[model samples]
Target: MKKVCWPYFDPEFDSLSERIYGPTCRVCIDNESLEDCTVVKVDSLNKQGLLLEVVQVLTDMNLIISKGYISSDAGWFMDVFHVKDADGNKLADQRVINYIQQAIGTTRDPPKPKAYTTGKPLEPEPHSERTTIEMTGTDRPGLFSEISAALADLHCNVVEAHAWSHNARLACVAYISDQSTDTPIEDHHRLAAIEDRLTTVLRATTSSATAGGNCTNQQQREAKSGGGGGTMTNVERRLHQLMLSVRDFDRPLAMMEVASEEGGKASVLIESCREKGYSIVTVQCRDRPRLMFDTVCTLTDMQYVIFHASVDSHDGYAFQEYFIRHVDGCALNTEGEKERVVKCLEAAIERRVCEGVRLELSAKQRVGLLSDITRVLRENGLAVVRADVATHGGKAVNAFYVRDISGNDVDMEFVESMRREMGPIDLAVRNEKSLMPPNTADHQRPRFSISDILKSKIERFSHNFVAIK
Candidate 1:
């Protein structure tokens, strides 16, 4: 047959083998075994959610899959996946099957679109005729309300308003309409009056009046220093402090040297702070070490310093004099730094309460459930005392302790509304006496009187101690 070439039997058979396998499906090649490959169909409407759920389930099952595809009509999704056990066999597991079923069940129908007519006249812009006042400064609380109230007092209509803050600063945009612009009150004069009022209010409301005044004066000085471009005024400072207290992530550091018996209590505090998302710089344990005040001052980045003598009388007056002497630019004198530190600590405390609430409800099936409870609390203007989430038997168990939860002065209807929003949450009123225990020997120390110290000092210095609950 004229020396017929038999490629199968020839030495060049390797080239033929490569050609045969070159066009193999990516799904089949990646899995390396045909038996490992699985093709599953999912509902197209909820494909994204189903895919995410399936991916999470697969990750848990130690399975690997390649790219997926959607079919025509957008009603079906096809996923090619495989599982690798210790033995390397690619087979679907019970978990994968359950996940697929769950995904299918959870698939939702696509939302229907509403028809809209064209060629209709657009609605006129709201508040176009109103006088707009643009206020810019470091973000803080009550600024918007105060501005609105001031406008109201001036017989001005607050047509539109919005407030935003960043890095301990606030800016507000408000539109006001006055009956007559020809009156003695011009926009600039009105703004100046409002600014003055805000400064007075900030100084009055602050726990540290001197510090508040100093901060206001600093802003004024800065404005004047810049040749009157006008820095953030008093209202802005208050608003900024409030915003920082509520949102900033920086936390005060708490350092302690506890015995092995007290270690557990300290751990609880550390865990509480962690739950609240406050950063813990350090936790040390030692027996009768030298009083190192600078270490705390350096590590904590605290402008104000305070030291509490341990419960054991043996560790007395550890580094108090050193701290008073060495630490310069103390918050006691620097008003801005004091307020910033106070606001930071307040944020930390709030974070702790939030964490406690979350820990108490850790057994809940969904995080959204807890979020709903918090939303309700915020809507009703109720202060959350403590929230804890704990898990038992693979289910989230939650407990909410709130202040003024009895609904005496608050509307019962609103309380019921909040209860409804919580959706089967275990809400409870906090017992104040139980939460705050009586002072022990540690509380009676002759060191710096925490209560006697000015609120500014306490607020500034408290950042060094981490709150557990």
Candidate 2:
């Protein structure tokens, strides 16, 4: 074995480390530096997973990252981002700027684990009226129907939810409350029963056509209640982590062939840098919000350390490059390993590109609301590819990206009829031209803001549904 000298052995390394990791953190915003977008410059320590953390914060705020330049190969981390709000305007709100600064600067110290002298963690305070359920299982048609039906049967009202499926694996997080009381269910037995019911529904498989093969493996059928087992901060990010944990990247041979055939314009290329002891991965695809966050989250969860990276978007296309290595400090040494990395990165990028029409719904909160909505979709031969469910005040504001059961484009005529049947005032279809595949051309992405949708729903909530808090 060859011996490698450690960089920290030099005494000067200590001073440099202290200076970079000092208590003071800086996040500068310069609107004058860019003609089209606001520029955000960050100088902080190169902490593990720091890149993903920053990207995640901006993404969750619904900010669009037009371009990014990252350099964190050493102790210091420095980066610049060109960002715009959802409406394609530079960030102008002082409150928003202050929030970004605080969020980026306050991550130096990770939250400490609770004291566990008795070998058990302290139970967190119960969420006032919402209980979140996290589940992972086989991906199949009508799976969401079954899960929502089960919850409805148990007298639970779905408040908010998100689900993702890829490579024949499904993961979902749902927030629910007592249907009658509108409060969180604290009974241990009831919670366990809910878990059992949902687990059974997820484990039931009707065919072998599921993309990755039969899902009889015990690891796939899992259901946990109590607010994602007490650590569910970001539902979408948790979905990524759950999918990675189950190795959803390992697609079946037939599925891989189909994906390759339908690869569209997205491409991933891996190149070796033997001289530098690093492997470079480049991804090219249509530009959209949260593109950088998705790739960075996948890399961090896969145990690959990104030493340096660059991101840019132009003419409706995105280009991202990463210099990465295994956490073991070794470059990819085999073709098989490289291929796996490529497949995983591709999966990460595609998982968020929902393939279907976008439907936005707003209604008064009530029991069996979710079940009824999903049942209608199932009856109309529509399958949900992505869903975001949320509630505010006393209204449910949700979005569903769906396709036909046969995996074809939905008929707009039929969708219009369905909307009419379901009350056109409550259910509306937005312009999803921007959500098209990367190969699509000449379609300008639309500006759809979740906050704006929520506000509109809340404003229209006649006195009947308003709750005086």
The candidate that wins on TM-score is 2
The lDDT for every candidate, in the order shown, is 0.33, 0.74
In candidate 1, what residue range of length 10 has the lowest lDDT sum?
222-231
Highest-lDDT candidate: 2
Clashes of 2: 0
Off-target runs (Cα >4 Å) in candidate 1 are: 1-147, 164-171, 179-187, 208-469
User: What digit string (tens of lDDT, one per residue) describes model 1 on residues 1-469?
Assistant: 5897764677667456337543111122232335545544433332222333333333333333322332212323334333344333544354435443443344244212111112112232233344445444322233333444445555554333334433333334444445345122245766566556544433333434233222333342111000111111222232233334333333212111222212212110111122322222222212121112112222233332221111111222111111111134222334454344444533322222211111133323432343454455555544343333323343445554443334323333444675566555432321221111134434333322112223332233242231111
